[model samples]
Target chain A: MSVMIDTGNYIAAKAAVMARPAVVPAYPITPQTTLVEGIANYVKTGEFKGEYICVESEHSAMAACIGASATGVRTFTGTSSHGLLLMHEMLHWAALARLPIVMCNINRVVGPGWNIWTDENDSISQRDTGWIQFYCSSNQEIFDTVIQSFKLAEHEKVQLPVMISYNAFILSHTSMPVYVPDQKDVDNFIPKRIPKWKLDVDNPITFGNIILPAAYEKVRKDMQDSQEYAKKLIPEISKEWKKQFGRHHGDLLELYKCEDAGYILLSMGAIGAESKVSIDNLRKEGIKIGLARVRCFRPFPREEVLKLGKQADLIVIDRNISVGMEGAVFTEVKAALYNNSDAKAYGFIAGLGGKDVTFGDIEKMCKKVVNGKAKQLEWFGFEGV
Target chain B: MLSKDLVEIVFHGRGGQGSVTAANLFVAAALKDGNKGVQAFPFFGAERRGAPVRAFARISGDEIHLRSEIYTPDIVIVLDESIMDMVDVLKGLKKNGRILINTTKNPKDFDFSKKYDVATVDATSIALKHEILVGGIPVVNTPILGAVPKIFDRVTLKSIQDTVKDKWKGEQGNKNVKATQDAYDGVEVDF
Candidate 1:
């Protein structure tokens, strides 16, 4: 039964988290702290089982999570932009060790001059870390994806860390209605599946040992193969999530109204919701436009993304920039559609450092891109006027 | 969209103003009258003193479908006047929505050029009379919550009472309940 309960997004996240259950190891940071507090609170109240480590820093948090997961425990943690940056070095270890850890990344803007708002730069910065990444638009999606992340990560074919990202203040602070499933239902659906290579005291196993150059390529290739396997396994797990939870996730990459449309706007995070409004308004005004929300950014849904650009003029909007280069998403979009002769990709860099990318900005940008006059690396709604 | 209608109100205030506690009171009162409701605070950036924050309440007979921010808020209670200047607080207010401002000054003293109805209450004075701490930041949100049912007659006092009892249980909670009651009794309603 679908019950629409009006809950704070943070509370919903916390409730879903408690139900799924995890041994949390997290440190507090702006925008992302409330989530940490919520999880910590649960641990303190004995509502959730497992050790809650008050780690020194983001790096230690990931390390503690790695330790917990390696020992065959369901582990979880969270961090934001800079904290994710600190955990960068440990991400490689977790992926190499193939620990099926789940993490919540409250996506915030990375800075040259210290700013704490919202952006995808932090998560996008670690695109090559071999962790499966999912971007959530709504609070409900955040709750749903966390449940699915575990299933996807723990699968035999793909045992890797998963990071679910949502814009820090936008979705994190913004209150919303979240439908929480019955705890019994979640347990029946998620059912604890310990991996084959679990750390057992009776049978000791070394994890993340120093690799010699001779065997490094094989180890790297195995990691690569696991990621490729995840590309397929994600759908299988999502299928189960739908049957149990009644939420059909479109694909690794979800396209919104792109069929037969002349122009398409590509985005991730909360911006996708805004783009929907822009698309609807443009449609009313006789403009054929659509939105493509990148649900899974890592183990990138290459084929689906390429196909999205096939029938329409593609405009890629990335909240995170690649410094010196255009937005990282645009580069990936271009790479996806490189061989597709029919598709032309336009890049729209927007919402850096918590700047509110309004529906009006999206409409204006789409108009320019469709007319073939939009500049590459164009910052949406930047004030010059 | 039920026959009675779902009006999701968001109250923006600081930590000490009793915004969250007041919101709980409102939800309690609504639920007592058998109206389904919810009250929740935003994922606070920091619970530091004098920091801007918000809490929400979704009230209706039927379940709520709209999980997003109440973009077109039916009612906006600003406990702190400074919040109005900080953000576009009135951006998506419904045409006929009401804004209750808790301040020491009169309604005319503050700008109300917007088309919606603007009401002001000197909650500081009422709170002072009750010997409620008035030296620090004022607990204007409680009085505002109490006075709101009068402005929006659809909201019953009994519902607020129920929500308060269900949510807030301690002496502090009881004090808030009584404070809300005093606020309800003290509405001047001079428009």
Candidate 2:
């Protein structure tokens, strides 16, 4: 492995190329443009041996991916904000049909206000799309997860699509030194996609045809079964990667100082990384606060959340809201602990519209809960709860 | 949190001044110096030229886990001195922090020299002298990086020259390295 100093998008681009995807269909968008550009550079330099297609729109990009992936070849693509939202329908199609397509979605804020900054709304809004969601905090994790996603997605036990999300500029444009493993090692880690099924012209078969209600329900149930299997397989793959590369960013969840603590802070993306500073500062002040950075949002990690809830109170700081309801993670975490454990969890809506959720802001939220002064839910930095 | 081993620096310049590249290249040099952790990123918004822009970098003796922007910087670099007119370049500088500017005048000319350590270099003139022009405008990012090694001991002028050469090859690379050397020699500091 060699250390490369560059931005997150470029590192992810190298990882994607190293994974050796057969086809890439991409469209440009803010914060996501550099990532695709990096891939194109690799293709021009002959490092990438794939059919790189320049699609018209975000919709066509995913459609092209679906078309290529249905042929039983590995496929990868990336986008952010509106681009990911535009592929909403195809996202469902890829997952329902069990294509192991992998993508990187830059976590940018949704529009109408025309703001292009870091927020989790883009990927969080696609929660029910049946894709395995992974939120990464560091460029190294982005690099590792992009490679690992292909392995996890294409696993026989879990043949589902994967979406790797990182904060817009906080991660997407940030430069850090990431250790790029040798191609031989990466190829050994992620072998060619030996799919169970595919479309062949010689032995033609129907794909995504109309189905009856009973068959459709069975498909949905099978997806759930695969997700549960994914929860078990994610850690196994992560462990193997670590054994090979001497680096692992955790699987399902990355815990920081959470072995024994009364209060545990919960978050994802860049804020999850910044929470370590808050935890360190709070620990110095005699607060037994730990951090459980949610790495995987689905299969929801209910078993893990239940375990954490049984141990300590959870304070969730979510960067995405469900409009009329509270923060998305808070809603789900509370449900995980409902009647299952006696632990209490508080929710704070923050970083929406790409507002800076600094370590100071995170510390303030944790202090409120530690002092027994927080409500069930509050909009951070807003006038009222 | 003022962790003793970490140093944060913010850069101020115009849209086309390469402030973002300055941070990136500067941190790359620091990484070569064997620092365990380094980060560089730009405060991105609109893409209008001549608008005040900012970039940030951090150097640490250990691995860096914090991902927030540097709220309080230990050093500030100004690629375009005129940016001071519209932006507060020293918004959150630490006490006795250093501020480097690309100005023709001596470091004593700036009132900020009284409070913070000041370093001045004619980076614009150096870029022009080496004919480093992009779209017919002097590119000061590389020249200012030359002065960085003078302030931060962890980064060396040799490392910056090597990094620049790796980014731009042949005649372009030689021109940037020579411009960097000139800026390093021309820097005047009020310490």
Candidate 3:
């Protein structure tokens, strides 16, 4: 029923097929190309029954998904940095129209310098786009999260698109053992997309034709309300999923040995996984440090973060920079903790453009935190900052 | 074989030489042997055929949460002997680490750090002997990988054979199995 496989892309593709999406429109990009290619193979081999559309560009890819989603069928798509940026307008269109399309965005650096390496700037820049984001730390998590995204997005209480992301090539190209479930179990988990409103000839409706400013405000408010609803629904669904599948990645944040710790390090994506190793090594050295891996970024996990702030000194590690300011997560955490807690928060920016950030680098950061010599904003693994 | 410590390995080869695939297969084989945690990833900017590339793998007795690139590897597996002339393959290798090179020359002929235990095998010949060629390029990855378990106790030849058989089938699989077994027996290690 389950097998060990290499690459997160293939695992994501397998999960997509098992979810039985009616339509999948995707374009080829570095790192993300293999994901759609695997889907295309499934389609060719007759293992997957979905319509796999090889669109011209990332813009066309999202547009096709939007078109398919409007017809009340389950739709899926995947893209990387520039590809995702190209779908900027359509990203907004899908969210506002309330089409529950699920997409996987491999986090690659946006290029003027032409980099194809891993970075979170691509997805972090889309934080304001109204799409619910889930950052995965492992191949198994990628498979599980992509499968969970469909059920969460399609929930009537939360009809919003979900962007599942992991670092480009780190999880994408990395090989690991992932336990894939049988199709019957997956069917029991995720039901078919049955929308209340759809483009049907018998039941006519108008979508995105014209909206006054006041109506647009209400529509935006409803979207925000659904996001609030999703924050609560995410954990419930994860619990149900765990009850059935025997696995549950913690709701918005996965805390590792943080129950009784003086210092807690916060991170997202692959860096979070690396920090766990750092925490384990640090614990052996008698340092009271732990890791709180942020699973969902769009909802921002305000309560969980505030709870962490109350318990320990928070060290936020960001693979992305807000530019002219500190790291994006640091900025969000600081804003969330304002007037909420007096916990000292330090920001460390690391692994931009695929720079390697190891356990030793993380342990050093923890040591600095322990020494109380950490700056408010520091560039990790950078010398002579 | 189970060890308390994690075994980290770095692979050096050209882009087309299947170093990344070798790394993945190695980890897959380790997982098949019931190792709790395993990870393999490639590090490249703009990869192309004939360009030097690096890939890394880690096999741990416990769950591996570290996703960072391997800095100090326990073993450096060189798939191509020519890459040795281009870069210091021993750069971040541990002082007691082992060097496994796919070369026809003897291990003593090469100048390497005195701390490392060097091993050599004629993987290209084995690949050619097995006629494992992809687009006329002899597939040396499997043969080199086969030599790995011979030198290290972390994985066994049977596990490598089973993984290979699962990956490739029919006559192609048989050829790979034969190449792997031959290389496993032929590898020469100097402590």
**Per-residue lDDT tens digits of candidate 2, residues B48-110?**
788888999999987788788888899999999888988899889999899999999999999
Poorest lDDT segment (10 consecutive residues) of candidate 3 chain B: B1-10
Ordered from best to worst DockQ, the candidate numbers read 2, 3, 1
Candidate 1 positional error at B126, Å: 5.0
DockQ of 1: 0.22
Model 1 misplaced regions, further than 4 Å: A1-9, A12-16, A19-22, A210-214, A382-385, B1-15, B19-76, B80-97, B103-116, B125-138, B149-162, B181-191
Poorly placed runs, candidate 3 (over 4 Å): A382-385, B1-3, B111-114
Query: Candidate 1: lDDT of A254?
Result: 68
Give candidate 2 regions above 4 Å deviation.
none
The estimated TM-scores of all candidates read: 0.85, 0.99, 0.97
Candidates sorted on lDDT, descending: 2, 3, 1
Candidate 2 clashes: the total is 0
- Return the lDDT, model 2, position A171: 93
For candidate 3, lDDT tens digit of each residue in B1-191? 12358989999999898998899889889988888789898985678999999999999878778887887899999999999889889998988899999999887877773567899999999999999998999989999988998678889889999989999999999999999999999999887
Native-contact fraction for each model? Answer: 0.08, 0.84, 0.78
Top model number, TM-score: 2
Candidate 1: tens digits of C-alpha lDDT, residues A201-264: 8998876678899798897898889888888887777787787777865568767778879888
Best by lDDT: 2
